[model samples]
Target chain A: MQILLASSFGAYLFALFRKEFIYAGVLLQLAYLLFRASELGRLPLVGPHDTIVFFTACAAAFSLPFGRLMKGEKAFGNIISVSSALFTALALVYEPRNFPLPPVLKTFWFETHVVLAFMSYALFGVAAVFGYLYLKAPQSLAETLQYKAVLIAYCLFTLSMIFGGIWAYLAWGTYWLWTPKELWTSILWIFYSFYLHARLRQWWAGRPAAVLGIAGFGVVMFTYLGVSLLMKSSHSF
Target chain B: MNPLKKIYQILLSLNTSLWLLLIITALFIAGAFIMPDNPGFGSIDIPLFDWLKRQNLESVWWLWGTIGVLSLLSVNTLFCSIDSIIKKRRVTHWLLLISPQVIHTGFLFMLLAHLLGASGSYHGEAAVAEGSAVKLSGGDILAIKNIEIETDDSGYLSGWGVDIEYNHSGNFTESARISPNSPFIYKDLNIMVKDVQAYPEAALLQVSRDPGAVWALAGSILFTLGILTLIALRMKMEKT
Candidate 1:
């Protein structure tokens, strides 16, 4: 309770000092990562959503530093807050377990594959948020940030497919089965693929780009959450 | 034409492509909604004849891969959109030329490989009883290399395990198992890990062929690297 309270307060304080806030928030997030690790010892992350929370938390911690890299408007502090809030909420929904993974997920590749997957998902999630804002806001400090966010997000979605394929090869005995999850995820990425296309094409700039952001992100949510609820999670053996 | 003028010209025409995508996605969504949730083992025959239909099976035609037509439709939307971007030269040469773009091109190749990749299948399930030899997906002979089953204190759905070894086309040997999760890949084929069925020594597995498997792999590797570079760059920027 105290740790979470302190972390929330720390985030609030950092929000006030947006300039230096990103770095301060990152350090605090890193501490929180350690804090969670200590409580559970080793990695408390297990299960589908559990891993998502764990990696998103890490990505949130890392995004601050990444946001800092952007040239002009450095509003990573805001990004961090959003990410942290998301992870915190996710934590409420998913509980970490110590149980061993099912047979198909018992491989070393499973850990690497899933960890990278959730991390990328987290990054995409942030990008989706920016995409949403980019479409709605006529123009603001976030415009430049939104473009950067899409570039980064598209990159992650692209990789998610790549890693997913490799992981699929190792576990499911095939790379692309066109399963609901795989099919939808690939479609989601393709949607963004064109979003990037449009953005670079510059003909469909701004609002069109933002619309892609919404459509692609919706697909992501569907692939990540909707699939499990509607169908299944993990490709299975 | 000046670059800006050319760019504007392209923008004016994006409307057609945009409307087309909207129509396609809407139909896809509506079709998905109307389709039955569970389309049981409907006849999965390569060439469809109405009488060939499996009885009581209602799986969506699209869900069955339907000769990959549904996927191709979606793929068409993606390709057209990509073409529009390319035709206009709006591609971010710098970013797209980097590791991220490599990831995209890799994915495209992988999908192509999956669709056009050379692959084969195995039908008969292999049941090995603690060190027995059996044939796998292809005609390749595989032996139950090892078998170890662990039961928890109560042993209620805790799961079981087994290991398998097989010889590939050119004497290449591979093995797979759960609990540790190391699946074997032989030549272009992958004989993934599995649990022994009733005997705790036999294994069940799925087999496939996608000649472009390597491209899928390459795409994944590049994607990871691209992500790392982007994040790492961000981390470095935070430091300064």
Candidate 2:
């Protein structure tokens, strides 16, 4: 699956270089998603490996319409394709095992929380890609796209946090824990809140907002991977 | 200008909010990275403010500062919401104007819930074997009736369930099945089976009373709805 995703991303790059190969890349992306879903017997969002693949799929899928919407902006597509490929490769490196779901995880809130959180992360990833593109090209459309993506991501992230709190309360008898993961998650949310508010200010609206968007993705990466790997916390996933 | 009016202006200042947010973020980042791991803080019964005060003052000065900033931010949020509502009363885009206030109100409600919970909540755990009773505060008692555990092929625990009977004033009130995801709520108390031990055949049940959970949940829902409404209205305005 990783190989196919990497190859599909390569095809996307090739299509960007040679404009006529776009359909081949799209077909490969769709095939990869289908194969992965079939293999997992569900959406590719169960574990770390699956989540990475799922995020890569989302980036590739969004790139199709985004690429078409912003014609002559092949760089945006290239950025997303490269990022997706990198994530897919990272997924392979992480090599998440298909452990059976624990009883605690077999809840509606767990699925909703994980899915929404990952979806928001993927959107933020895209926004970061756009932020980079905007810094390079300074297009109004890129700015708008980055803002819109962050808006949606913020909403989903909020919902994910809330659902997580509810799940925590159900399992642990506490809604808010001052664990490292929770702290970082709150920081990520606050950072974006600042970003959103700053975007409204005239001085910070354009390139500065783009910079914050990119920086926010760095925070997102740290929140997602850093706490899990670098720190000891209750969020074992 | 009157002193009270000056304070209100300061609280309503967006500049104050931005600065407070920055400080709070920095403090949280420091807490996440620098503070030693203390599992005891996760308990609902621990009053965070009291606990912070009890910590080594030198080591946790940042925490103290963070609390101060957060308190200020809460006040700022309240005043900012009021100021916005008053200022934007005649604005044609009522949805756009009010959505942020709704989010602010939700934020305040959540903060208030945390405050109420920190002072009034109770949390404790008890290990009870089958047919044993655990006494709780307010003269409540919980009796464990049965313990069921399901194991996979490798003898690993797949699932576990506990049947508990709530007794108040020595009278049986209700029975509940407590499982991993399903917690029993009796009055304001939540009873959840935390762990199961074999041989001894005991279940560790955590009981907590959080009077503010409902308010916090409602606040979260309202906050989410407010953001969605703001986004929808903004999108519509952009389209138009």
Candidate 3:
């Protein structure tokens, strides 16, 4: 708990200074998460709510690599780092360690498949954020940066659906159930597909696409978090 | 026209993508909400609603359709990956090879493996504790040993848990408990415990296959590189 607080504080402080401080923030986060991972792996966390918290934290962690890509724009790293810290803090608060995996998640696909699917979902979550920001640029402030984020998110979102289908097939008798979760994901995929096309067409520019990117992130959240709780499906969460 | 110019033009166009995404999302959202209070059967009188389960949160249609869309996506990806490789775009090769875009290529492989390479199957029984092997049309058998209905710590049922053995082609045998979350995998096939029936024998499992999973890992690495490259370039541009 103390470590969580410290990491959060560190992320904020790093965000403020950015260039010099973000690395330290990232390092602190690694320290905190690595220590906590063992404890986390023991919990159930199978339901939709639990998966959301778990996936969000992972997405934040995945964002770390973007810092290296973002180059000298430590602000990018700072943003990803602090946001990840914030997500972890939120998870600790709302998601108790008790959300154990139900019987459904015990399958090979549920454990490994869902984990990968959600991890990709988490990564896309960040990409969606960056995508929104990119499409909404004051003057395409960081066009390349925005593009990178969108591309990354697109890949993750795409993978999440594909892997999810495979997992669904293993769990259910069919590969495409089009349940709420699947529907939202397909919708999300279609949106990204268009976003990809938009990028090719240069239609939305930064603002509309940015909004869509942000919105895509929301859909990603719906697929990852909302669908599980609100809808009933054969899926584990 | 030079290929580079054509490439730039195609890459930069957004109208096609934006409108298509909007349409797709609209249809999906509409499909999601128009559900009956009681799903699975007709809560609504519309005959099409029968064909289309209530777009309820619990609708089976949503699940089935998602699987379909993803399967299509995998095929599309496979086609594009093949095109990218065969069309011999020097720039695309570098782009796909260097950027997270390559992950898309890997994703194609993963999807193909899950879709075509694995088998999805289900498990069920006619009555409780009948303990008979659920037979598959493919000649495999899932023999049951016991049944336990699982629940939360609060005792609300999460789902069913079955201790069963899977015999494949009469040569391979392994034991696993098929519950909602705890599925069994054999020979790359994944078996999930969907439901159990009392009177008529019924068992459910979702199956998937992907031959290109390892490539996704490689694509992830390339994606990280692409991200770094773009970020680095952005920072450099900002500084200058």
TM-score of each: 0.68, 0.92, 0.59
RMSD of each: 7.0, 2.6, 8.5
Chain A only: give the TM-score of model 3.
Answer: 0.71
Better of 1 and 3 by TM-score: 1
Top DockQ model:
2
Each model's interface RMSD (Å)?
A: 4.3, 1.3, 5.8
- Model 1 TM-score, all chains together: 0.68
Instruction: Tell me the TM-score of chain B in each candidate.
Output: 0.56, 0.91, 0.47
Between candidates 1 and 3, name the one with more favorable lDDT.
3
For model 1, state the Cα shift of residue B51 in Å: 15
User: Which of the two candidates, 1 or 2, achieves a greater DockQ against the reference?
Assistant: 2
Top candidate (TM-score): 2
lDDT of 3 by residue, A128-179 (tens): 6565445444445454445556665555554455555545544553445535
- Order of models, best TM-score first: 2, 1, 3
Native-referenced Cα lDDT, model 3: 0.54
Cα lDDT tens digits, model 1, B1-240, are 899866545444544334433444554453344343544222121222232254333444443443344344434434544564566456643443354444445555655564545233221233457677766544678777676666656562345556666677437876666432345555665554444555545565444344567766765665567666756666566589
The model with the greater TM-score, 1 or 2, is: 2
| Per-prediction DockQ | 0.25, 0.70, 0.28
Candidate 2 C-alpha lDDT tens digits along B91-126: 757888889989888888887888878677777888
Give the distance in Å from residue A209's predicted Cα in candidate 2 to where it truly belongs.
Answer: 1.3
